[model samples]
Target chain A: MAKGIISWIDRRFPLTAIIKHELTEYPTPRNLSYWWNFGFLAGFVLVLQILTGIFLAMHYKPDASMAFDSLQTIMRDVNYGWLLRYLHSTGASAFFIVIYVHMARTLYYGSYRAPRELLWWTGQVLLLSIMASAFMGYLLPWGQMSYWGAGVITNLFGATPFIGEAVVLWLRGDFAVGDATLTRFFALHYLFPFLVAGMVVIHLVSLHTVKSSNPSGINLEDKDNIPFHPYYTSKDGFGLGVYLIIFCWFVFFAPNTFIEAVNNNPANPLVTPPHIVPEWYFLPFYAILRSIPDLLGGVVAMVMSLLLFAVLPFADRSTIPGGARYRPIYRVTFFLFIADIFVLGYLGAQAPTGYVVPMGQVATFLYFATFFILPIVSKREDKWLRARLPQELLAQFDRTNALAKGQNKGDAP
Target chain B: MSDSKSMDKPLDCPERRNFLEKATAVVGGVGVAGASWPFINSMNPSADVLENAISEVDLKVIEVGQSQTVSWEGKPVFVVHRTPAQIAAMQASKGGPDPQEDTARTQQPEWLVVVGLCTHLGCVPTRDNEGWLCPCHGSRYDNSGRILHGPAPANLPVPPYKIVSSETIIIGVA
Candidate 1:
């Protein structure tokens, strides 16, 4: 009887074994810091976006006449529809926050170094796709911001050299950003999250192929690593719970906090808002686009900003520091890159005039320079440090390095 | 208590068993009560309720030489009230081969009422001097709800409508 009962209980509760396998069997590098958690957090945010977006789409109207009213209906009528809309809107912002942090984590820890370069490149592409998805979603409501934002962004394609106007018209489906544009944008916006999800799976698969790098910058060499279960699982769960609480707060108490009130008005083609600004996340790139006096140059600058991420693996010279005990210059340059991004974001929000253009150009130059100068700086610094190291310190380093090497060979699968 | 305990030794006392059962019942009762709110909230509208609900629209607000819009079943309905002059211009245009064989085949004459949604992916058609324009996919409709130069595969739908009063119309009713 007792055996039967145990078997029944086991059949009813299979989650335990699954959890154990995920958490205990999976080996995670011991050096992983809080930075590693953002990838998981980004994944969590992606799920949230999909859930909220699916709900919102149920009550949303894609047509021009009813689009505004449909939004109003969702806010006013459908059960918990307001909650769904707010969650989706705010979720977009939160998604960007986590992705930016994830990218920063990569930069700081040199997670973009070799073998993981493809993973980082895929992540960069995913980021660009996310931005595009969000931009298209912003236009679905047919509100003032949706109208003008779509118009301005579609017009950006017109900045291309010879066939710019034709490309812009093709994108618009008409001479302007109207019904055709909104319909296509809605379709693409709805479709992109799934693509991003696919990319994320690939990113993780690639990530797992190479052992995760830790803050110590050390690669795994032995079974000193802990299973991902109770250790990291509990840690990530706690992180998720805290994140959800903040997300819920935004959804419940401050649904419209991120939405501009000016966007509440219907889209007017003839009337241009005094200042046209892209969403906050796009501001840095937008600033770069505007900094160039010529249209072609502005387009090039904007594209370059995104393309730089793909080239990062080869940009910096520092040998993948097996540990963080070295490479101070790389760290400083990483911070400078962050500062440049923030400065560019600020400049993007300002009107294009006087010092804004010049400042943006300087920032844009520095942004590219960080990538171009990294390898040279890393090589020079490594050479200097090797020559200047004391004999005693060098001897100790050699002993520890050999020990680590021996451990690595022993631990290999 | 001694008598009850002695009785419980053989078969559980009725009062004690009843009390324990009631306690379990109360706990389950409270759980059901706690869960009912969100459960009911998620239930879909009944078929009967949906059947009786407003699925059509009235297009009386449309004026001659102007277009009027109404919402039916959460979609836009455009009623173009064309003047005699506008109707004549539509008849004269021959720039492209006509998608519709007979312009006179349409039931509505001076006032054409169509589901304002574009044939290509359903963006609400906006009225300009030329005709109805879909801002979503660039599909355009002529004054008589016929597909003009656009990717629209079909003309705008005309909801079944009737004039209830000089200024009022009822749509989606036979």
Candidate 2:
């Protein structure tokens, strides 16, 4: 009976053979730190967003006239609709935070090296797609903020060189971001997250194929690894629980903490707010885009900043197998890269001015220099190491040491 | 012996069974509690009756060539006290405002009683020279609550109304 019950439970649960193999056959480097857990955390947040967003969309009205009223209805009427709305809104912010951390983790660990370059590139594209989805979602409420926000953003196309006017007109679907634009954005915003989910699955599949890199910068050639089951499974669960606690706190108490309530008022096209900033996640690129005086140049520079990640693997030439133990130069460049981003974010928030022009130029220069500087520094470090070891001397020393150790051990016997 | 020892334990442990029972009871309790609110709210004496209540308006408040609005069934109902001259002018401009010129149009003349909502998107139509104008969706309705232009599909709804006193009107469910 006991045997029968055990078999029954195993059959029902059916821990997939793949999972069992991952647990028993494959061994992860034991030295992995908390940073390694972020990818899984990001995946978890993606699920949270998709689930909550789906429910919110059920009661949301796509039409301009009813959109605002529908949101109000959800807030005031539906059972626990307030909770669902808050969860979705707060989940968006939380999603950005986790992805940023995950990207930073990859940067610090040098996880973007050759084999994982495609993974990093895919992730960058995913990030860009997520930003688009979020920006579109912000305009769905048809509130004052949503209206003016869409107007200002869609008008950016008006900055294009020859066809700027035509581009802007096409984007608006009417003369401006009106009912048509709102309906289209609602459709795209609902569709984009699912695409992001598909990209994430590919990211994980790629990640598993190439075993995780650890802090020690060593590869596990033998059976030194353990299955990913009970060990990593428990670890990921604990991390998820802690993240959920923080997520729930924001959902319940401060859903609008990151959003402007002015957005709740009806959108007035005639009135423009003093400062129009994109959501926090896009602030850095938005800053870069604004840095250049020329509209086309600024747009190009902004696109390049995001696309620059694709070139990172070629720029950083360290053959060091593990992720964490980066050379000193790489470490300093990483911090500089972070500082450049912060400076750009600040510049984005400020109006383009005499001081901002120079600051933006300097920040942009440093941003590109970090990528170009990596290959040179990595090459120099490699040569320095090679010069320090002479092959014949190393071989002679090894032979002498072996003979001496053997003789000493034999004498003792 | 190892297998026999394991089998000796019961299929349902008392501790596990008790925990399951408690969990189910807690879930059932919450379900019951949640189900009671709507039931209790529905039972209130005024809940359903108040929604259909009629409103009384003082027609004297409305001057000649002007419109006065009163609440009926949570909606605005417009009552216009027209002068004999104004009624004659409206009749002269008959086909100009009322397109169909049906019985509904013929019925509305000196005292216009129509729902004060835009037939297009349900915004409360603000009174203007051309009768009522919806701020949202830009639908226009003439003084007789006839659809003039824009996307409004039909004319404004006319509430069931009766003259209560010389200067008073009562609007209720027809």
Candidate 3:
């Protein structure tokens, strides 16, 4: 009887066919490393965030007067509320960790090359949407940092050339951050995650269209490919197990690691905190904004810093398939770029005084310089690497080079 | 017979079709914008918020050289009773970074009023012996709230306020 019912449903819908094609029998490169697990991990964190957030939102208030006390009620009064809140908070940090690692793996493997540009672009949009969600979410707690951070960030709109003050007033729903701003942000904060989920669907569709890029960066034959079900599902399950252990440790033991201490105090518009700092994730961009002298210029610089990531597909002109693996110069620059980001983040957290000022300016310069330098060096390095290729490898190198340029899509056995 | 056949024929008018297509797009665009207008305008400061914009502070209690903070439009307004020496110094020194006369920053020499938030990133500046110093980025302001040095491009903003009686000063009137 169950078999007959399944067949009836299968006739109406392609349910079984879709399950076989996408889940059970989907093909993936056999050589994929543990780095490939981050995409799965990011999806896991998103669901964790949504589930925890839904439960937390049930007991929390979004008003300026009640928000802080509501959170206190959740911590002290509600059963298991603290666990849900901590899990949600830590899940945000975990989400970024997973995404950054996923992006780094992509960069390292040259996964954002031709034929996958749309996939990379979709991922960029997802990053921006996630950032918007995080920014709005931070304000829901109605803490001192939340208040001032909203004030400062909304003031960024005041840098607009003509209608600056009006834009700022509209954004805050008043002359300063207050009740109206809080309610609207709370609504948007809840809304953005679903938008992010939709974007993730688009991202996956783009991904499945081009398929996964392996560490070697070469499009392999079907013989080298493995079904995603038994092979990758098991590997991903193991990775998720390891990630959860670390995530839960932070959630239970050190929940406040990602939360600012000043946020414990209720938001007071009259008093801005002595030393105001944004959440750790925003520090690098905040540092970039601070480094510039002009308000409008700083806002522009900070925005460009993010939008520039989209240019990576074009900036990297190297015909080589495997990124950094076969190229020495690209590898060195990649590490330098990471170090520069660390410096910027560190400076962003400190008072903008003494050595921090000059250091920040220098680091900000280096950040942009890294992008500008890539295109020039990549073309030269490709030529240099080609000249050094052995006779036997030259014909094979030429074939792969054309493939990397996206001349063909046939990855058949 | 030819006239009857011509009457039955369909007219292939490219210009008319093109105009209709453009007209439909424009009307649809206007409808979408009209539908979005309310949602966009909903974010602006509401009637209730605008109603409470005006705040009154009794200036009778504040002593010379002391400053009082009053909330207006949800922002801190610094009301300082300037000392004789402080007024003299500001009058003599040319206001910097953003140059304005000490007379311009104040309505009366003794009563100096400016918004407490930093002109740069909006952090509230703390009062000091010389002037108010912004703690976040180290932007210094003189007694008249003129920008002295640091990343701040302008002086502390003067809000629209009025002194109604000798003792009563109302903020946010303008």
Top candidate on TM-score is: 3
Evaluate all candidate structures by whole-model CA lDDT and list the values in order. Answer: 0.73, 0.72, 0.90
Tell me the lDDT of model 1 at A194. 98
Model 1 Cα lDDT, one tens digit per residue, A238-346: 8888888998898898878778787888886544455566788899998887667555677788999899888777765544353224666676777888999999999
Task: Write model 3 residue lDDT over B132-158, tens digit each, in one string.
Answer: 999878999999999999988899999
Per-residue lDDT over A211-309 for candidate 2, one digit per residue giving the tens place of the 0 to 100 score = 676665444545657667667878888888888899888887778897786777776543434445667778788777766655567677878888888
Recovered fraction of real interface contacts per model: 0.00, 0.00, 0.84
lDDT of 3: 0.90
Clashing pairs in model 3, backbone N/Cα/C closer than 3 A? none
Q: Give the DockQ-based CAPRI class for model 2.
A: incorrect
Model 1 spans > 4 angstroms off: A1-23, A320-325, A388-413, B1-174
What is the DockQ for all candidates, taken in turn? 0.01, 0.01, 0.85
The list of candidate 2 runs beyond 4 A from truth reads: A1-15, A22-26, A158-163, A322-324, A385-413, B1-174
Best prediction by DockQ: 3
Better candidate number, 1 or 3, judged by DockQ: 3
| Candidate 3 CAPRI category | high
